[model samples]
Target: MTSSSKISRRSLLKAGGSIGLLAAATQIKTSWAMGGRSRVGVNSPEQLLALSAVDLSQAIRTGEVSCVEVMKSYLSQIDNFNPTYNAVVSLRDREELLNEAAVADADLKSGHYRGWMHGFPHAVKDLATTKGLKTSMGSPILKDWVPKHDAIFVERLRQSGAIIIGKTNTPEFGLGSQTYNNVFGITRNAYNPDLCAGGSSGGAAVAVATGMLPVADGSDMMGSLRNPAGYNNIIGFRPSQGLIPFGPTKEVFYQQLGYEGPMGRTVQDTSMLLSTMAGYDSRVPLSQKSSPSRFAGSLETKTQGLKVAWLGDFNGYLAMEPGVIDLCEKALKHFETLGGVVEAIDMQYPMDEVWQTWLTLRHFLIAGGANGLYAKESNRVLMKPEAIWEIEGGLGLSAMDVYKASKARTSWYHALDKLFDTYDVVALPSAQVFPFAAETHWPKEINGRSMDTYHRWMEVVTPGTLSGCPVVNVPAGFDHQGRPMGIQLIGRNKEDFKVLQIAHAYEQASQLTRTKPNLKKA
Candidate 1:
């Protein structure tokens, strides 16, 4: 392969014309079109638009392609579909991104490769700060707030040579499981525009699924990464707490439940992104030290003797949408065929108690984080109902309630430790339901059970959050409505790489990651 950098502008325009002609001639929806149609011809720009980040990076490194060409391809796709999907919000000027890519191409030719992600276009979740780009946390209050400095992880992404394109959308302060905010409206699923794209990483997942981006960065607290990945048929890995440094915050020793990690179309791509995102920083007191290479280097481990505990619906105690359990069960059976042993496991701890404990700690964090905004009466009206509810819930907790919640959390960790002693991994559904309608803020009920709180419908993912364990959400299969679903592999605490190993093995055996959403009508 050779770089196409020298191609004349006229030739590039002619090539673009040919792509349009091919789409009309075959009546096959090109990658730029929506409504689930197949992508364009092989080796075409349309195909390049769909390459994984790993492959795209290698192409730039080896001079097989110029960074400029790659950026143009992705930007074109984003232009065509973003209006419908509402995935890539707070977008930067295109000329600026293309200019940066041109410089990257020039540097590569001069034998100055910055890193693996050199020249790749990326956007951080809106919850994180980005210098000179709108950093709205999906709240109306921060609609015009562009930070002068980047968030720690965002800085790391820049140091690794990723060209920052913009910021993706999230829920109001990332308060809900669905990605809709007063600032930018709802982010629709890439697979089906009329359906919801699970949040608060919904924008990140949709970007990856729709070829708007090859990979993205997301944060998870109560399954933000996993739920969106499950709904969009991609990979969302929430590394163990402190594995990826989180804050330059006022309260350093707080409950520490949320984590930032990578989202991608494949496990390898996700791991490759994690390599850059994970490292120690003194500013974040809880940061852990790990060699970046360990993430991608350890992907080849075999699963021949692995023991996986399948906790589908936490042993059938949790409510699930129709066909969710069956789809996940069929996906788990692939592990048995890969020489791994699968067994049914039941939780010893009461799930309702665990759910309540999670709510207490989670709301505590929310209230603490929202202290500044809540101090001003004028800002209260701008807050979402869910945010207000969480703040009040946290404020209303008594000292004894917090102490009991802490005790329950400790017990939950102990139970997980005992389970890991006998099993290599515990598997479960990433989300309780498949993608819902785009207009609905949250599921009012599931399986005839009313969801009392806004986040109650997402109980299946709370255990991993409470235990502070690493969970990887991989593609399971699709529901009858043709929407995607996913299963999560939860590993022991701080054993982030081990969890990825099992997920990679399952990904290799099932090959479900090869599936892409059909988006021809958007």
Candidate 2:
């Protein structure tokens, strides 16, 4: 096979398209694939967007790149295209950010350079408190809630020299999978502007996908990170719970399931961000110290002979889109080609029971938090009906219900533990389906099976969240509709490096880490 035949994942969209434009810039449309329609922009520049944080970091550190230039490039993209996708919520600190970058450049010139993230532009989900910036949790209740001090993770990023540009959008209180809220509106997919960017980290994924930033930090509870990453054709890593701390909350709300994680265009960048984001925090009692991991440094190593268990549909609770499954299956073949052992395994856990337990706990925590808001009339008016429903559900739950659900969670983890004994990793489709319409929540009927709650359709992610396993999402390949799909690479407990190793190997072997979403104007 010729070098050209070995397609890089970055250019897969152009090469695999019907027109087959290898280097023909004109034939390749620059618009993002949206809702099964490709919007071809007139006079669209041939220059593609999408960059990894690692490369951006190296350029800035070696004086080969200017932080101002980096920030300008992304800021311009956001300015030009963000209105269509609604990916960025609020960006009032442009003057402040540019000033910070100029200072960083002066420092770097004087040999006072900070490592990796120095001067690189990045955004965090609005749920995180950024000092002096409006940190709206997509609810009007906190529309004017500006924190006086930065969250610890935000502080860590700043210490490493990361430029705080703006905050991304999310659902009301980040309670839903969709990114739309009353405050900042909705975030559309980068592939197609009309479809939903899977939330509540949708805006973060879209920002990274559309080249507004090298990477973004987001919190995931349900399928937030994984779904948005898949929808936007990027990598979203939901680290082992407690790896990235969530600061003190009004209540423990979804404490077991909620996690703050990193999203980027490639596996290495995601790993690098995870390293910076992971550490024990006094602020979050649940936070655990990772035993000094080197996720970024180990990306180039060979990962042959890693044991991976490929679970097709999580025992069929969720339906898989045709092309989504086909692309992931083909990507799995690449794993075997890289000398990794792939085996089809039967997960003995009950899907219905797990879904029920997750719902019980999730509703209790979320609604319980909403209870505080319900007491305030103004806050209660801004709360979404779904949020209200959840709180009502939580109120209806008896002490026995909570106890039974907790017990079931323990039992489920033990069952999952037995499978990890035979396999080092478990692979599955990141989302049950591709990016649907911006108006819909999760897909209701998939392959003719009716799903109950908005969260019930994407049950594959529950096991990973419940088990607190390190899950790495890799852009598997695009579906026939031009929408992207991803494969979830799950590793053993605290075996984050192992998952990163395998993802890096597949990323290198397939050479698909560089695929950039064509964000043509609608």
Candidate 3:
């Protein structure tokens, strides 16, 4: 992956089969095809790209490495690999970013340190707004919409001295977990370029996994953050609901289904970014008031006598691919080595009831945001079928229907509460199936079972989502074909740090991300 041997859109087209590659082809060629200082004779710069976010931050802050060199290294990585992976889009010019890095270097010379992320090169998930950056949200209609204001997290990133380089690709308006759209074609898996990079944080995951970006900010509605990290063999942590203030948007009160989180190649990096992104904001009425600094602290924790309950496919309710469970189970065995107790537990609550509750809430929230698009006759045509379905389902719901679903959701929470009392943490597969073909929209069926809706294949994630609990997607080793999977380590409500601590211990024992992917062009 050098600028001299840069990949063409035709090669990318071959890597990611036709779905919506034309727009992506044009965008990639236009944005990153401009040559940068290639990795040729740039071993030290290449090494800079591989540094953990924490390490990079220290280097920049102490002037051990100039910010210009750090930014240049990342720009080179993006120039070389982004075309083939399609992980980054709307990238800024290399000269402009290098200049900003120079300013950061000057600030350090003046002893004007900003924060832990001083001069860190970063990219926000396309779904989030960054002032002046093109935030397409994976929709061509909004491709030119430059936000005048930053999302709260984006502001935090900037305040911490991160230079926003660009936006990562996501599904159209982030409606699904597979990353592809009319806006950006598809974000391919880091290990296998032909496979799908799970979404809606697909681009963010790939960026972190491949060193296109050090760490990233992504929001999860379904398995948006967790699934992509699992697919890319990185760490994505979805904190407890309201742990990070999200959306200065219209329906902040009612919409509790989604959360904004951090993704990185390591738990320490992810948690450090979470520290920057978390903390209370009055704009979000439901925002957590607790300080987020604890997450940035040492993740080392003793796992002796830890109790973990493995909820594998809810006793056969989830239609897993043949080896998905086995791989996650093997990953879970690492806990036993740390003197943790692992037990497989059958779900006591009705899983279907949880599904129904999730359907109602998801429809209500997704439709709430997308209804305006659906209302306009012209724009309605631009929306995907799943978006239309969510809009229609939300429009048709009566107050009684919403009330009944809320009650069911409460019952489901009680069931999880009971489990948490017995087991310190609950574990499940992050995704029911492995990464599929990049060209496919979504999995219509799994293991001879028909998926009734677009997101039903991700049923394994609902319990954690609905419970407003913290969940960490810890990488499970790859399968025979080299497809990655992950295990979800879940904690009780508002116990975000506890979950991070456990995941940190397991991460240290497994040392999974240390095994870098063997990247190849399709």
Residue-wise C-alpha lDDT for candidate 2, range 37-154, written one tens digit per residue: 3323222222323334665676566665677777777788888888888888778677887888899999999999786899987787898899998898998888998888887788
Cα deviation at 231, candidate 1, in Å, is 0.5
Assess candidate 2 and give its TM-score to the true structure.
0.88
Given candidate 1, what's the lDDT at residue 62?
Answer: 67
TM-score of each model, paired residue for residue = 0.91, 0.88, 0.91
Candidate 3 lDDT tens digits, 282-401: 999899999999988988888899988887877788898887877777777778789987777876567888898998888888777887777788888887888889889999998888
Predicted candidate 1 versus true structure: per-residue lDDT over 1-522, tens digit per residue: 111112223321221101111111112222332333343333667767666777677666767678898888888888888889988988889899999999999988899989888998898899998889888899888899988888788888888889999889899998889999988999998778889999889999999988889899999998999999999888999999888888666677774788899999889899999998998889888788777679867587877888887777765678888778777876777787778777767665678889889989987888888978987888998998889889988888888888899999998888877888878998889888889999999998998988888988898899888888899999887765677888989999889998888888888898777766666535
Error of 2 at 168 (Å): 0.9
Mark the regions of model 3 whose C-alpha exceeds 4 Å error after superposition: 1-43
> Between prediction 1 and prediction 2, which has the larger TM-score?
1
Q: How far off is residue 14 in model 2, in Å? A: 22
Clashes of each: 12, 12, 0
For model 1, give the 10-residue run with minimal summed lDDT. Answer: 15-24
